[model samples]
Structure formats: C-alpha cells, structure tokens
Target chain A: MELLLVRHALALPPEGEGEEADHLRPLAPRGVRRFRKVVRGLRGLGVKLDLIVTSPKRRALETAEILADLLEGESWVSSHLAAPPSEALLAELPKEGRLAVVGHEPYLSELLVWLLLGDFLGQSALGSLEDRFPLKKGGVAWLEGEPRPGGMVLRAFFPPKVFRI
Target chain B: MRDARAWVEHLRAHLPVALSGKDPEGVHQVRVAGRRLRVYLDLLGWRVLRDDLRRLVQGAGRVRDLEVVLAGPWALPQGFRRFLEGELHLAREALSPLLASPWTAALLGALEVLPPLEEGQALRALGRLEAKAKRRWKALSLNPSPEALHAYRRALRRVRYAKEFLGLPSRREKILQEALGNLQDLEVLLGLLEAFLSQGADREVLALKEALLVEREKNMAEALERLGLA
Candidate 1:
C-alpha cells in the first residue's frame, strides 16, 4: 500500500501558551490561499488515493477537508495520526490502494523517517533541508512499498516551495 | 532527569549548534540531540513539535556524513575538497529557518505539560534499550559483517542516547560509538572513492582509492577488535 505524508498548510501561531490553544488553531487565510497550489501540484501528479486520514487538530482537519475535496474522497479523523504512528496502527489501515495522511510534524517526518530508515541515526548531520525533501506547511511526501520498518521508499517529496499555492 | 523536560532542553540548547552545522561535531550533536528530543516527545505523545527540527536534522545529517568522509586520514584532491566545502556550506544554510520557527516555543510548552516521568519508568525504558543494544552487539561480535557492524553502531548510538536520557553514564557506549563511527567513516570514504573510480578517475585518484581501501581494511579490523570480534 502507498501512503502520502501531507503536512497541514501553514497556520497562525497558537492563541495562547497552552497545548489546547495550539490544537485549536486553524489554517490562516494565507494558508488556505497558498494550499491551492499544493492541490494543483497533486493534481498535476494525477495519483489517486483510496482513502484519506488526518489528525484531529483543526488545521490538519482543514487540510484533510481540502484534500478530500480535491481528491474526490472521504476523510476520516484518526487520533493516531495526531502523534507518532505505530506499525500496528498502519498495518490495520485499509490496504486497497493509496492513502494520504494529513498531519503535523515531527510526527509526520518522524514516521516517514522511521519508515525510510530502520532507526533514526543522522537527521541533523549537516546540510540544507530543501535537498532533504522536508515537509513544511502544505508539503507532501509520497511513499510506497511495504510499511514495515525500512521497507518503504520515498518516490516523491514536494515542499510548499514547489507549489504556487 | 526526572521528566521529559531535560530531553527537551537538551535539544533546545543544541539546536543552534546543529543549525550552525559547519562544525562536524556540532552537526552530529544536533542530530543526536534532536532524535533524543523526538524520543521523549514520542513517549509523551507530542510528535507535532518534531517536524521543524527534523528539517535541520536532515540537512545536518547529510553534511556531517560528508564532513566525516572529508576528515579521513587520507588526503583528497583539491577539487573534491572544494566540492565537499560547498556541500557543507549549502547544508548549513538550509537549517536557518528551523531556528526562527515559533513552533519551537510550542514544543517547550508541550514539554512542560508532559507528565513527570517516574524513576522506575525511566529505568525500565533504559533497560529495554540496553538489552536491545547488547543483543545487537552480540550479533555484530559474531558476524563482523559491515551491515551487521553498522546495525550495531546504530543500536549503540540509540542506547547511548537513551542512557543519557535516563541520566545514566554512557561512557562505554560512547567509546563503542567512536570505534563504530571510525569504521563507518571508512565505509563512507570508500564509498565515495568507489564512486569516483566507477566514473573513471585518473591514475592518481585510482591510487588514492586503493590507499583508502587499504585504510578501510584497517578501520574494519580495529572496529572488529573494539567490538570483541577479533
């Protein structure tokens, strides 16, 4: 099964210093406007997902909504996507076709890295994040092959900079 | 040591050095520090904060690997040296935004709210990690294959980080880590030399490649001895 790790579009800062404040924060107007480009980029790629799951956070929900609408699919809220995902959680996923996960980072990046590299050894060794296929706001990473540890490979990774939206 | 705050602070303090990624140790420290933070954050169920730092980690990781190769005892050509320097410069430049991300503040707040870790829980976690490391070390000691040795190095590195997280001494793990790293460095250098040779390097470069392969054999032998395989 293929999975796409999609970071939510850029959102405004938390309204307060609390975690709840961060959780409740939604996408900014600019974020919504810019994410259209990401949509276009995905459209350009022309790959279809069988399902879409997203974090429960407001911004992630909104991104999921956008993706669901754009990709012509239904979206579900999975609490697991809000944090680091477990292999069991992933194994239980519908294995029919491709799936897209809309969430925040380091959860998304950590999950992707864990999927790519068996153990996290050297993430910050040295270099620009760009060449690294970093998932900024509205960024998307394409992955496939087995979901087991170090069994997956990255096919495509598009940052927000890659899209006009 | 009692809670996740220490790990968070460790990452917060070292992030800038990782961002400044020109220094090899600094880059290596930052990557290790960030993963340590991720480890705790994962335990606390707050991985959202890890994304921004992961970018810095990625950039620093690539450059540090290159730096390690360039730092080898063998002399490299001026052209390759310039290429490596440019690569390092670009890598350091990529991590600049991570320093500015306000989301980092959110991570600190998240750390504060995580339930204070109990001593027992910390010890248990460290024990599990140590056991895994020992198992991996045993395998490497038996096989001494490059792949097995590399896996052992990774396991030891994780144990070292986890040991530090548990506020335990990681001196032995650190020593093993250095020996394993030296062997890994040789592998990385030999990889580049092989790539150059594949591209049809000149006789001088070919000679350098041969010398590096000989050095690789020595590094591997030392690494095996350190791991008690010899």
Candidate 2:
C-alpha cells in the first residue's frame, strides 16, 4: 500500500471566539492559489491517488477537495483525523492502493514519526520529532509498505514550496 | 486571546445582516457570535466587554426566540401568527438601533484590543468553568424542577463554550443542551399562550393551548427520562 500524508493549506486565523470557529475558518486565497499549483505539480510528477481522507475542518476539507479535483480521486471526511493520531486512525484506513490523508499540524508530523519508528522515544520529547520532521502547510510525505507503525518506508517528502510550479 | 480582534470583527460583520432582517440566519449567527465573544471575554476577565456582549446576545436573542417559535411544527392560528409577526417586527426594530448606536460602536472598538491570554491562563479558567458546571449538574435531582433544569442548562452552555475555546469536543454536552433547550422552548410557548389568553380567549386559541399543554407534558417526561429521572 502507498500512503500520502498532507498538511492542510494555509488557513485564515480563526475569527470566531471558540474552537468551533477555528473549524470553520477557510483557506486563504493565496493558499488556494499556491496549493492548486502544488497539486498540479504533483499530478505532473505522475502521482496517482485512489482515495483521500481528511479531517472535517474546513481548511483540510478544502485541501482534500483541491487534491481530489485535480488528482481525480474520491474524498471523504473523517472526524478521526481531527484529533491525535491513534491506532484507530490507522485501522480505519484501507490497506490497499495509493491514498492521501489531509489534516492539521504537529499531529501530521507526529503521525509520520510514529509510522517510521513505533513508540519512538523522541515522540515523547517536546518538539523533537516536529523539529526533525517538520511538515509545513500543504506539504506531502509519501510512504510505502504496511500501514502499521514502524512498517512503512519514507519514499519521498515534498514541502509546499518544492511542489509549487 | 490573539483572536479576540477577529471575534469582534466577526460580530461586526454580522451586525449589518442582522439589522437588514432579510435573513433569519443573520440574527441567529449574531447571537451565536455574541455568546462566543462573551465566553471568551469572560475567560480573559474583560468584564466590560463581556457585559456589553451579553447585551448584544440578549438583543439578538429576542428575535431568535420568536423566529424559532414561529418556525415550530405547530400550525398556529392566523390571528396568533400575525401577533407573533408583530412581536418579531418590534424585536427587529428595537435591535437595529441598539446595534447601530454609538455606545455599541464604542464597545466594538474597545473589543478590538482585548489583551491576549496565555494558554495556561485559559486552561485554568476553563477548569473553573468546568467545576461550576459540575456543581450545577450535581445539584440537580433526577426529577428537577423547571427552574433547576434551566439553571443547569445555562451552566452546561458555559462549559460547552469554554471547552470549544480549547478545541475539545462536546457531543454529550450538545445533546443535553438540545434536550433542555426543547423543554425551555415549550415552556416559553406555554407562557406566551397564557398571556394571549389573558388578553382574549377564543375557541381556536384555547384548543391550541390545550394541545400545546399536552405536548409540553410529553416533552417534560422525555427530558426527565434523559436525566435518568424515574
């Protein structure tokens, strides 16, 4: 199975007072423009996605939509992606074909580290994994192998700037 | 707390739509934004802005309550419907000036610079809010009176909003809020019917009142069941 992890595009800072408002915040216009080019650049590189799963938050959904539109893949929203990644998140994903999961910060980087090194000691160290394996907004990381922790090999990683055509 | 200015801007963005009264959702959104602002301000100990935001929510709330009642499933009599429409109109009219007034403008301006609160401070405030909500929940009996239920509902709303600030899910809190909110709506309807009866009671209105009474009873039973009351 091939896995692609994506951080959502740049989103407007939340305008409303609560977390609910944060969920509703949309991607910035610049984010949409740049991410479109990024998606197209990935498509040009022959990246093929069969399915895309995303956090239900607006920015993640928007990012997945852009990918699905340009990449010609199906997209689905899952509440599971909005929180800290767990075994359930991995279990919920299919073990076949190329798939992309779009979500937010530290969680995405943390998930990457977890997949490469199961129960990694650095995972508990504050900012250690993130500093080493930063996933900037709209960045994509590709991994190939089993879906379980420590079972996948990092094939390639593309920061948003690298993908901008 | 860095988002306080954004929150104020959001409320400001909704004000014109609310004043236009073209969309019922405008008022509803304004009320929601106002309530959220008040909650955040309360956490920051911005009492003046919090109090002003309360007034804003209360103003929007008047229109929102009538809209909800009018949109209910019950087929109200033409006369009663017209009466409710008049009330809604007055509420909207009253809301316009309040939203447009210089004091409100000043309040919005003052709100733009709400001091940022540290994450630790916010979490501590949320803890206090949760404790208050827990106490209110504990005070309620399995079969609580209408007033007790109402108080508990308010407490739950505060906790729910506070949790939202920290990006926590509140599905159970939301469910309870919905159940209690329905009961409260029915209670308000019953009160309005009584007031209408005092003015003049026709057979149609009287019949409607009896039907509503039965519905309220049924809802009350369900709400109690939800609270695990016998």
- Among these predictions, the greatest lDDT belongs to 2
Candidate 2 docking classification:
incorrect
Q: For model 1, how does the per-residue alpha-carbon lDDT over B1-230 read when each residue is reduced to its tens digit?
A: 64666656676677666666545676677676667765554333333434544654676677777778777676888766666677666666665664544334444443444445466666676677678878888887777788788888877787777667666799998988886786787777767666556755667777777787787778888878766688
Error of 1 at B38 (Å): 3.6
Residues B1-230, candidate 2: write the lDDT tens digits.
24566667788888888889888888998898888777786576433344457778899998988888899877888888887898889999899998887546645644554445667878788888888877776777744677777888888887787777767887888889987898888777777677667888778888998998888778877877897773
Which run of 10 residues does model 1 chain B get worst, by summed lDDT? Answer: B41-50
* A73-130: candidate 1 lDDT, tens digit per residue: 4444455776675775576467557888888877777777777875545556322232
Task: Provide the TM-score of chain B versus the true chain B for each model in turn.
Answer: 0.77, 0.90
Model 2: pairs clashing at backbone N, Cα or C within 3 Å: none
- Candidate 2: which stretches are off by over 4 Å? A1-165
Error of 1 at B84 (Å): 1.6
What lDDT would each prediction earn against the true structure? 0.69, 0.78
